[model samples]
Target chain A: MSLFKNDSDFKMDVLREVGNIGAGNAATALSTLLNKPVDMAVPTVSLLPFEAIAERVGGSEAVVIAIFLRVDGDAPGNMFFIINREPARRILQGLLGFDAAENDNYSELELSALSEIGNILAGSYLTSLADFTGLHMSPTVPSLAVDMAGAILSYGLLQFGTMGDDALLIDTTFLEGQQEAEGHFFLIPDPESFDKLFRALGVPL
Target chain B: MTEGTLIKVGMADLNIADGGAMLRTTGLGSCVGLTLYDPHLKLGGMAHIMLPSSDIAREGQLNIAKYADTAVPELLQRMISKGAVTGRLLAKMAGGAQMFAFMGGTDTMRIGPRNVEATKLALERFEIPLVSEDTGGNYGRTVELNSLTGVFSIRSVQHGVKEI
Candidate 1:
C-alpha cells in the first residue's frame, strides 16, 4: 500500500513545487556562503523501498558525510544534508580556505565546519517551507555522521517503518557552478504530518 | 544453482538458510541483524529486526520479522523446524548502532542500544548463549553467516572485516 494511492496528479505537483521552493531558498543561501553560483536540480519526489533510497546516493555501503536534524512542531519530519567526499573537500577548500586532505579521515574541525554548513542550509530550507505552508516547522540541533548512506538514510525511515516498507522522500540535488552535484537535501516528513501539510497548502488530501 | 548460495535478507525482513547456503543482511544501522546457528545441522536463521518490541506497533497487520521480541522466537522456531537442536544453537549479531549522536531523553534517539538490549533479553529468555557481537557504534555494518561453519562475518567502512 502507498501513501499517495488516492492522490491526484495535481497533489504530486504541489509536493514537487514544495520541494522546489525550499531547495531554491537553500541553494541561494549556499551560493552566498561559498560566494559561487550554486544550481539546484528539479526536486524528485518518490515513494521508495529502503534499499532503493540508499541507491539514490550510491549504494548501501557507500561512505558519505551527512548532517541530520529532526523537524519538530506542526509538521514534524526528518531532514538530512548529504554530501559526497570529493565535493565536501571542495566545499572545505572553497569556504574554509583549507587544503583538502589526502585521506578520508576528517579532523574534528573539518567535521564541525561541515556540520555548521549543513545547519545553515537546512535552516534556510525549512524557513522557506514554513513560510510557504504557513505551518510552524523548526529543525533541531544538527548532528553529523560519516558513515554508509544506507545506514544514515535508514534513520529517516524509522517512522515510516511502522506503516510499511516504503517511505516518501523529497530530494533536491545542489550543484556547484556547472560541475557535478555538491550536496543533497532530503526531506522525509512523518506519515501523519502529510495530512497537515496538504491541509495547510489548501490541497485536499 | 549451487547449494552454497548466498541468500539476502532485507531490512525488517528475515530468512533461514541451509544446505551450505550463506545468510546475509546489509546496511544495518540502529537495526540488529540477529542470527542463530546450529553447527550440528548446518542450519542458520537471520532476522533484520528494526524495532525493540511489537507491543507499540499500531500497524493493522504486524510484521513479525521487524521487531526484536517477535523476530527472535520466529527465527528460533524456523531453526527448530529445520531439524536444528535448540540446545546447541549459538547466537551472533551485529549492527545496532547509534548512527547520529543526539542529546536527549527521547526513546527514539536511543533505539539502537535499546534494540541491542531487547535482542539480548529475548535470547536470554530462550537460554541461548550470545557467543559474539559487534554493536553500539556510530557506523553501519553488513553481516554474513556461513551455514556450514557457523562463522559470522561483520564488515564496516570504518573497521574493515572481522569474523566472530
Candidate 2:
C-alpha cells in the first residue's frame, strides 16, 4: 500500500511504459515464431485485489495453460505467459506442424514446445527490459502448467501477499492478427522492487 | 432449507457459514484452504491462507486471514461468535500443493508444505483435532466444506472430486 505512497498515477504511467516496451518485444518474438503479424494492446498497470487478478485471464476456476518463471536480479519479480486452450492448440498445430489434440489433455511434447516458446518470448522481454533499465534481470527456467487461472496466477502473487491483499501488476494482452486473443503477459514485481525500478528509471521517489 | 448455498471465500480471506450453507475456496495453489466445522451446531468456517506466518507481513494494515497463524485464530473467533464451540470444532483442509517444482529451488514457491505445517501448528494451539486433510500434491485444488454435515470435499483438475 505504502509502496505507492503518493504519485500513484505517475508511477502507474511509468509501469505502463515498462510493460509497453517489454510486451512489444515479446509480441515481435511471437510474430517471428508464428510467421505472422502479432499485435499487442496497450499495457495496463493497476493495483488489483487478489480475486480480480484472476479475472483478468478468465475466472478463478477457468482452466488455461500458463508458463511461469521467476525473475531474479536487481528488479526481481514473477512473470507469466498465459494462453487459452484454443490458442495453445492452434499454436501447436499451426507453428510446429503437429496435429494438436482437440481434447483437454496436452501431450508432454506439446507442453515442452509451448514452454520453449514462452522461454523465447520472456527472454526477449527481459533482455529488452534489462537493456532499457540498465539492470540485470535474469529468468529461471520456465515451468508450464495447465490448470485453474487463479491457481497458476496466485503463485506469482505470493511474494506480494506478505505486503497486502492487493497487488500491482503490469498486464499486456496479445492478439493474433488483431482479432483472436492469443495470450497475456503479466509482470508482477515484488513489493520492494518498485523502489529499485523507480530509482533506476529516474522517477521521483 | 433448500440446497446448501455456496459461500465463496477468496484468497487471503476467511468466512463462516451455517444453516446448511457451504464454504468454498477456489483455485488454491501453494496456499492452504482450511475449514473448521462444528457438527453439532452445523456451523463451518473456511480461510484461504496464503502464507505460513503473519510475522512476514510488511503491510501497514495487517490482514490476519492471509496467514495461517493469524487466520486460524481469527476464523475460530468468528465461528465461536456464531455459537460454535471450540471443543466441537474439527478441521479439514486441502490445497497447499507445490504447483511448480524446480530442481534445487529454494522453498520460496515450495511454501505449500510450510503453509500446511503452520496451519496444523495453529490448530494445535486450540487443541482442535484435524479430522482429515488432502494436501501436498503438484497440482491445484478447489475445496468445499458443507456446514450441515461437515463433509469436506476436494476437487482438482488432476484428481476428480474426493471427500475427506
Candidate 3:
C-alpha cells in the first residue's frame, strides 16, 4: 500500500535533498539564535511503520518536547521539531537565560518560549523549501507539546493512516558540537501532497 | 499484584488476550484505544484505532485494525471465536485526545472526536454496552486492561494513573 511503490531511487534522492536544504536553513537559524555552532547530519528519508517512527526518537513512551506546525499551501504537510528533555533544557538555558527545573515540568513561560523557537525554525524551513521548489508553502501558527514521541508524532500520521499503516518521512537530526543529536526535524508530507511536491520540484509524478 | 503476561497493542494495530494476560497500548493521542472484555471468560481484546472509517481509504489493501468501523467488528469476531460471548461482552475505551489545539480547526484536527463517535456507533450496532470511557482531552494516554480483574487502568503524564 505504499504511495511510492512506483517511485524510483532518484525520487528518494530528491526528497533527501529537500530535507537537507530545509534543515540546513533551520540549523543556521538555530545557530544564530544560540550564538553557537549548530551542525546537522545528512537527512534520511524513510518509509516506515507508525510504530518505528517513535523508535527513532527513543521509544513509544519516551517523553519529548515537540513543536508542531501544519504546513499550508500547495505542498501541505506536517512538520515537527523534536528534542529530548536534556537538550530542551539546554536550549532554554542558552536562549532564554533561565535554568530549567531539574524535573520535567515546564512553566507556562518556558513552554511559550519553546513554542516560539519552534515557530522560527519551522518558518525558515518552509521558506527555504518554498524557494527551492518554487512552491507556495507556509506554516500555520506553531503549537508546543511535551509528551511521548509516539503520541505527538502520530498526529502527523493521521492523513497517512487512511492509506496505510506506514508513512514516508524526511528526517534530519541536528547535532550540537560533537555530542549526540540534540534535536530532529521530521517533515511528513501528506499522502496527497507527494504528487504535488514531486511535480513542483520538476519530478515526473 | 496479579502477575500476568502483558500483551502489547501497537499503533493502528489490535490483539486479544486471555489466561490472565493484560492487554496494553501506549502513547494514544487522537487515536482511540478501544477494548472489549468478557468478565465471564476473562478474555480481553484491544484495538488502537487511528481513523473513523475505511470508506475513504486510498490504499489497495485496507488494514482492518486501523479504522474504528472495521476494527470493532474484527476484534469482536476474534473474541467470539475464542469462546467469548458477544451478548455478555462489555466495552471500555480511552485516548482520543486532541493533543494540540489549533485556532481554526480542520477535519484533521477534529479526528479525536470523530474517532470516538465512530467507535460508539459501531459498538451500538453490535449491542455492546460501553460501560465507561475516559476521553476527549488535550493530552495523551497509555492504557492497560487487566484480563483477570477487568480493570482498565489509564496512565498519563498530567493526571497520573486511574482505573475504571
Candidate 4:
C-alpha cells in the first residue's frame, strides 16, 4: 500500500511507459517468430484486487496457456505470457507445420514449442527493460502450464498477497492480423521491487 | 434433493455454510482448498489458503483466511459459534498443485506442498481428522463441498472429476 504512497497519475504514466517498452519489444519478438506484423495495445497499469486480476483474462475457471518466468535480478518480478486456447492453436498452426490438437491435451512437442516461444518473448521483454533502465534484470527458465487462468495468474500474486489483497500490474495485449486479441503480457513486480524500479528510472520516491 | 445456496469462495477468502448449501473455490493452483465439515449438523467451512503461515505476512490488516496457519482456527471458531461441535468436525482437502515447475526450485516455488503441510498441521493442532484429500499434482483444481452430504468434489483439467 505504501509502495505507491501517492498513487500519483505521474507514477502511473511512468509505469505505462515501462510496460510499453517491455511489451513492445515482446510483441516485436512474437511478430518475428510468426513472420507477421503483430499489433499491440497501450499498456494499462492498474492496482486491482486479486479476483479482478484473473477476471482480466477470464474467470477463475477459464482455461488458458501460461508461460511463467521469474525475473531474478535487481527489481525482481513475475512475468506471465498468457494465451487463449483457440488463438494458441492458431499460433501453432501458423508457426509450425503440425496440426494443433483439438482437445485440451497438448502433445509434448507442441508444449515445448509453446514454451520456447514464451521464453523468447519474455527474454526480449526483460532485455529491453534492462537496457532501458540500466538495471540487471534476467529471467529464470520459463515454465509453461495449460490450466485455469486464476490458478496460473495467482502464482504471480503471491508476493503481493503477502502485502495486501490488492496487486499492481502492468497489462498489455498482443493482437494478430485480424485485431483479435491473441495474447496478454502481465508484469507484476513484487511489492518491494517498485521502490527499486522507480529509483532506477529517476522517479522520486 | 431440494435446491440449496451455492457460496463462492474467492482467492484468499473463506466462508461457512449450513444445511444443504455448497461451498466452492475455483482454480486452486499452488493453493490449498481446505474444508471443515460437521456431518451431524450438516455445517461446513472452506478456506482458500494462499500461503503457509501468517508469520511471513507483512500486511497491516492480516487476512486470516489467506494463510493456512490462521485460516484453520478462524474457520473452526466460526463453526463453533454456529453451534457445530468441534469433535464432530472433520477435514477434507484438495488443490495443492505445483502448477509450474522450475529446474532448480526454491521454497516459494514449492508453495503448494507447503500449503498442504501447513493446513494439515493446523488441523492436527485442532485435533481434527483429515478423512480424505486429493492434493499434490501439477494441475489446477476447482473444489466444492456439499454441507448436507459432506461430499467433497475436486475437478481438474487433466483429471475429469473425483470425490475425496
Candidate 5:
C-alpha cells in the first residue's frame, strides 16, 4: 500500500521547490538590509497536519512577530511569516546598530524600522514564491506580539481556520556575519485555497 | 534601616505597607504590576496579577493578587486597612506586556491589555486618580517600591536597561 494515495506527494514537491526559491530571495533582501554577506540555508520544508502545529511550536514563553498575506484567487489562500521575539529584537538591533547603553527601550523609531524590515522580508519571500509558482498575493500590515507559542498559533489558526488542513511549513535560518535569525514560512490553504494553489502550480487534485 | 519588612506576596496576596512598610514581588512576566500610594499618608501598596479576570481563575474564589479584577479590589481593601483613605490615594501602574514574542497579535490573546484595562477600571471605580503609568508594551518589567519614601522604580530590558 502506498503511503500517499493521491497527488499529495506532488503538492509537497511543489511546496519545497517554491520554498527554496523563497529562501534565496529572502537571503538577498536581508543581505541588502545588513550591507553584509548574508546566507540563508535552503529551507527544510514539510507537510504538517493541522493538529501537530501547536505541538511543534507551542507553549514556549517567547515574543513573536507575524506577517499575514492573502493570495489572490476566487477563494484566497493565506501565508504567514513568523519569527520568535528574541530574534526579532536582535535583528532590529543588528539592522539599526543602536547602542544598548544609551537606550533602555525600543524607541518609536526602532519599532518603525522593525516593521519595515518585516515588510521587506515578507514581500521578498512572497514575490519569489509567486515567480516560481505563478501565483500572486499581497500582505497585510505586520503585527508584533509578546506571548506564548500556543496563543500565537491559536490566533493564526482561528483566523485562517481549517484552511491549514493541508499546510506546508518551511523553516529557515538567516545568517548575517555573526548575527543570525530564524523564521517560519507557513503556507495554508482551505479547500478553495488549495484549488487556487493547485491551479497555480499546474497540478490537478 | 528597619530591615525593610519583606512581604513575600505568594500567588494571590495583595500587600499594602504604610509609613515604613515595603511590599515586593519577584519573577513576573505577562502579568500586571500595580502600585498605589498616598503621598500624604506615606502609604502604598502593590499587586501582582497573573490573569485579567477572576472568572477565569482555575482556582475559584479570587485571592485578589492572582487575577486583575480581584487583585485590584483586594489591594484597595488592604490599603484602606493600612490607613490609605480613598480620596488620598494616588495610583502609578506598570507591567502588562507580552514578554514572549510567540504569542502573536494583541487581538488574539489580550491578557496584557486586559490586565491594564482591569487595573484602570478598578482605580476608576474607587475614584482614585491614575497619576502616571507605563503599560502595554512588549517587555517584562521588574518594579520596586519604597514605602517610607513613597518612591517607585521599574527596570526592564527592551533594547537595553530602562527605568520608569
Candidate 6:
C-alpha cells in the first residue's frame, strides 16, 4: 500500500529537497558567523546501497573529515557530515584568521573551535531538515578526523551499518567571496530509526 | 658548475638552504609540501607535513615535522635559525589531493584538502605571501623545489609536469 516500495527515485527526490533546506540553513549560519554573504549550491543527493559508498568516495587519495550525528524524536535517524580535509581546514582558518607561520600544532582550543564550527553548520542544517519533514530531532556532538581513503571509508561503514542497507548521501558546496568548501551529508538509519522515520513521514505502516 | 645538493626531509625535518639546495620528495598524496624562500638571506626551506596536527599523532611520533599543525612552525623556526628573516620570505605549496575517488561519503578521509587549507592559513598568519600553489585535485603529485632559485615542479598523473 506504500508507494515507497521500490521507489528509489522518489526517495532520492525527497532527500534532495530535504538537503536543499538543510544547506540553506547552513549557509545562513555561516554568513552570520563570517559577517559575509554566503552562497550555497543546490545540494546533490543520492541514495546508494551501503556497499557502493566506499567505492564512490575512496577513488581519490585525499583527507576526509567526517561528523556523525543521531536524529531522534518523532522521526529517529542517523546522519553524517563528510568533507575533504583541505576544505575543512580552510574553513577553520578562514574563520579564525590564523596564519601559515603560526604554530601548526592544534591546541585543544583550536580543536574545540573546529568542533564547534562543525556543530553549528551541521546542527542548523539538520534542524531545518527536521522542520521540513515535520519531525523533531537534534544532532550529536561533532567529531573530526584526517585520514586516508580506506581508513575513513572503513570507519564510517563500521560505525553506521552493514553494507546491504541503502545509505543517503547529500553533497553541497559553500562559497563566500574567494573561499569555497565542499561537503557531504550522509544518513544511514538503523532498524529502529528507520521505522521511526517511516512513521513520522506518514508512510503506511 | 653549481652542484645539485639533495636534502631529504623526513617527517618533521625542515630543510632550508641558501643558493644551492634541491629539496625533493617521491610519493606525496594528502600530505603538504611547503617551500619558503627568503630573498634577502638567499635562504630557502621545505617541509612535508603528513597530518594536520601533531597533537593528534601517535605517541613517540610527536614531532613537529610529522603534521601540518607543527611542521609549518618548525619549518619557519629552522629557516629563521639559518639567517632567513620572516619578513623577506615568500611561500609556495603543493600536494594534497584525494588520489582515489572511491571514499566519497566519509568526512574523516578528506585530509588532503585540510592539509592544503591549514598550510595556507599558517602561511597567511606568518604574513608570508603565497606566491604559487598547486592543490586539491583527484591525483597524487610529486614535487621538487629548488632552494636556490625558488623554482618548483609538480608531476601528476593528470597534469604531466608544470613549473610553479
Per-prediction backbone clash count: 0, 0, 0, 0, 12, 51
- lDDT of each residue in A1-205, candidate 5, tens digit only: 1223487777767656766787678778877886767776656656554335534543222444555454444434455666655666666768777642133255677666766776787788778776766766665566544334433443343322212232445556565566545566665543345566667777776
Report the C-alpha displacement of residue B138, candidate 1, in angstroms: 1.5
- List TM-scores for all candidates, in order: 0.96, 0.97, 0.97, 0.98, 0.49, 0.47
lDDT of 2 by residue, B1-164 (tens): 23568899999999999889888999999999999998898888999999999998888899999999999999999989989899999998998888897879787877999999999999999999999999998888999988888899998888889999
Model 2 C-alpha lDDT versus the unseen true structure: 0.91
- Please state the error at residue A36 of candidate 2 in Å: 0.5
Candidate 1: CAPRI quality band: medium
lDDT of 5 by residue, B1-164 (tens): 24377665432346777657666653344566788888887888888765666555432233456667677778888878867788988788776665434324444245567778887888888898988887766655556677777666666544433444
Docking quality class, candidate 2: high
Q: What is the DockQ of candidate 4?
A: 0.85
**Chain B TM-score, one value per candidate, order as shown:** 0.97, 0.97, 0.97, 0.97, 0.83, 0.89
Q: Which docking class does model 6 fall in? A: incorrect
Best by DockQ: 4
- Mark the regions of model 1 whose C-alpha exceeds 4 Å error after superposition: B1-4
Q: In every candidate, what fraction of the native interface contacts is reproduced?
A: 0.59, 0.72, 0.71, 0.77, 0.01, 0.00
lDDT of 3 by residue, A1-205 (tens): 5466566688899999999999999999999999999999999999999999999999888888999999999989999999878988998898778788469878888899899999999999999999999899999999999987878999999888878889999999999999899999999998888888888888887
The window of 10 residues in a row where model 2 chain A has the poorest summed lDDT is: A95-104
| Alpha carbon lDDT of each predicted model | 0.90, 0.91, 0.92, 0.92, 0.60, 0.63
DockQ of each: 0.70, 0.84, 0.81, 0.85, 0.04, 0.02
Give the distance in Å from residue A26's predicted Cα in candidate 1 to where it truly belongs. Answer: 0.8
| Decoy 3 TM-score against native | 0.97
Docking quality band of candidate 4, CAPRI definitions: high
- Residue-wise lDDT of candidate 6 within B1-164, one digit each (tens)? 13487776533346776667678653466667888888776677888766665545433335566567677778889988888888898898887765434323344357678778888877777888999998887555667777667788877654678998
Two-chain complex of model 3, DockQ on C-alpha atoms against the true structure = 0.81
